[model samples]
Target: MSPQKWDENHPARILLLKEMNEGRIPLDSNEMGPAEVYYKYHSTVEFQVEGMEYNSTFTSRLRRLREQIRRDQGKPEKATKTKTARKKKDVSLTWNENHPARILLYKEIAEGRIPLDEKEMGPAEVWCTYHDTLEFQMDGVEFNDNFATRLSSLRAIVKRDQGRAANDRKALEKAMKNHPVQELNHRGEPQWNGSLAQALLQQDMAEGKHETMRPSELWEARPEYKEAFSRKDDFRWKIRQEIRTKKYLYTLEYRAEEKLRKNLKKEGIVLPDQDEDLDGVMDLEEMEDT
Candidate 1:
């Protein structure tokens, strides 16, 4: 990869901020001006703004950036209630960039060697495939059981993040429908509430905010509905469903492990002695915790 060049579009300010956040630039930046701090750590990094001389303009530019950061930090809670939606952070940022396994995993992903689609293969399967790759061997990265766990975690984070935007959009739409920005009509005339707004507000306060539901009212209205849901079968069915899911997951993990073991054996890597199999080590209490 070519060394990154900083200009007007991609300022050294961004890199400076990132380094500060990650504790890489641990200098007392507030005391020392941005220019001094930047030059201290990133002395070799030549940053220049368009049509602006670096010696004269860079300090002023950094001052503006700092002021902007301060303004953002000092923003009031109510200031965020504006119609404009905030930018969401990328889901990939949740993973540690410096992680040995993740660095290789992301490289493979970028190279189109490893697909990010978890629907096609499980996390363990992905790790097993990743293990046998030339990139993994060339990097001299050793096997770790937690690689599979991290893959699963990252997949879950991505899935959850993907759903969040849709959920936010739905919520915004619902909110717009319920309480519009302009309550007045096209003619700028006062609209009739008909006590609906107040009633809705009261209902929201009770049900949504406080979660105060009237079970007795529902039971009286539909006795069968309550009886059906309250049955022991419903509770037992959930437990059975969870058991099935765990069993399926364990099976996938076992197969992935077996495949990895065989690959390692082929590569002349010593296999670690295992005291027990997955089934033998399965704890009822641990299953319940899940």
Candidate 2:
């Protein structure tokens, strides 16, 4: 029940305020709207798997998402749940529900405006289909630029995230190569210090030092991207080589000019426009080789 539904002078409201002051509870009475929370209870849906009882919103959402994907792929949707299929905690739920980009996408999905085969469609295609609608309409409210960009670049963003995950995994494997799991273990047995390893892995992922690149890092990756990165590197190398060659040729010419001036001085040959000082080698060097 909403706190607003109760009388302002109600004992529960007074108790809620007291609870807020105590700060023992996760919720703040002043922070929460009346309808936000009355009784601190969680709602869960029970789904049986392997004759074991489990209840979580994560399972329900994954079940729904898989079915949706299967339908999009022109395959029979898995309406029935598997007995052994269990849902781990949702890694995306916390981010997705609160994310501005996905929030806009979900709004479209909730409105039934998004096609069922959205999985098959790219973000550009989705944007083109609802470009005018999303760009202008927000229930007559002004369009938000942040939301607009997110809605437009939705698919690309998801693809990038997927690539990041793959890259992060690869990075973890490579890191573990040197610091073997057995080495990290105290007993030096086959047992691995998973907790420590996990922490390190999370730190590296957060730093994004090994995050995958698409067209830019292509040379180190796929054949298509290889050409682009290699081509750029080759161009840079050629430029550096040309600069080095010019520097070498210039150095050689300077030495040759020095030798020529020394020889001329030894021969006592005072070519035209003689300078009072003998140190004017630059002036002599400037003379044309006629």
Candidate 3:
């Protein structure tokens, strides 16, 4: 083919040039002479099947396929990070019935008033005063600064009265005759019994029969009476026992809700829709977890 035709894009001419350049075809003319060589080449062309003459054709096809694959497989986008919100902690105060200040404070709260701080006299004295108020025979009295102070003074008086009563009882018992008294029975001539001695002792045991006394009375009393009247330790032991027996377990559910509502109201916090039964709204499972 002409060079101009070869450059102009003829498929057959391109294939022939490519085969000759790849050394797949031999170019020797003297061995076979021109006529025989031409005939032999023609015969070989008719009988032999053709394949890719060079590795470049295979590599070029592979490069095109790889480019196609890269185009089809797109780049992945980056993921965005998320933030989790933290849960809020419960900040409510829990008051127990057994707490010395609880009853007094709760009483004031129930009466729509606030209690004064116990810092002035001391926590122990304040607690004693609160306890005295429980047994104090008064109506419509409210707990405040003045009330706490007065209650503390009253507790002292009650303690003193208890001591005096115990002292008076011992004196009366000692003065009673040691011998048994003679008494006639329904069907007997005479009977010897300690009924009089027992009666005197029982009379001394009666409550509210003795006048109030001070803390110093036991020591300040006559020397002979000191041994009989000294019962401060016994009284303290009894008081401790009574406290253990009388202490009540308090349920916090209703009280907690009421206090929470009151505190929220004071802080201007608006609550969402609520169940009428507050107990039902609280999660028992969560409470058990705590």
Using TM-score, give the best candidate's number: 1
At residue 59, what lDDT does model 3 achieve? 28
Best by lDDT, which number? 1
**What TM-score does prediction 1 earn?**
0.23
lDDT of 2 by residue, 135-216 (tens): 1221121235544455546545555666798999999999989666553234332221234423333344345532443223
Off by over 4 Å in 2: 1-101, 104-119, 122-149, 183-290
User: Judged by lDDT against the true structure, how good is candidate 1?
Assistant: 0.48
Could you tell me which residue pairs clash in candidate 1? Answer: none
**Candidate 3 residue-wise lDDT, 147-251, digit = tens:** 555445544544566679999988777766564344654433233133342233234333322224332442343342233234445333433333232221122
Clashing pairs in 2: 218-225, 219-226
Model 1 residue 95 CA deviation (Å) reads 26
Q: Where does candidate 1 have its weakest 10-residue lDDT segment?
A: 84-93
lDDT of 1 at 260: 52
Question: Which lDDT value does model 2 have at 226?
Answer: 32
Question: Considering lDDT, which of the candidate structures 2 and 3 is the better prediction for this target?
Answer: 2
Tens-digit lDDT track for model 1 on 181-283?
Answer: 6655454533323334333333443444323434333333344333333543442343344445556667656655565554433322324446545662345
RMSD of 3: 41.9
**TM-score of decoy 3:** 0.19
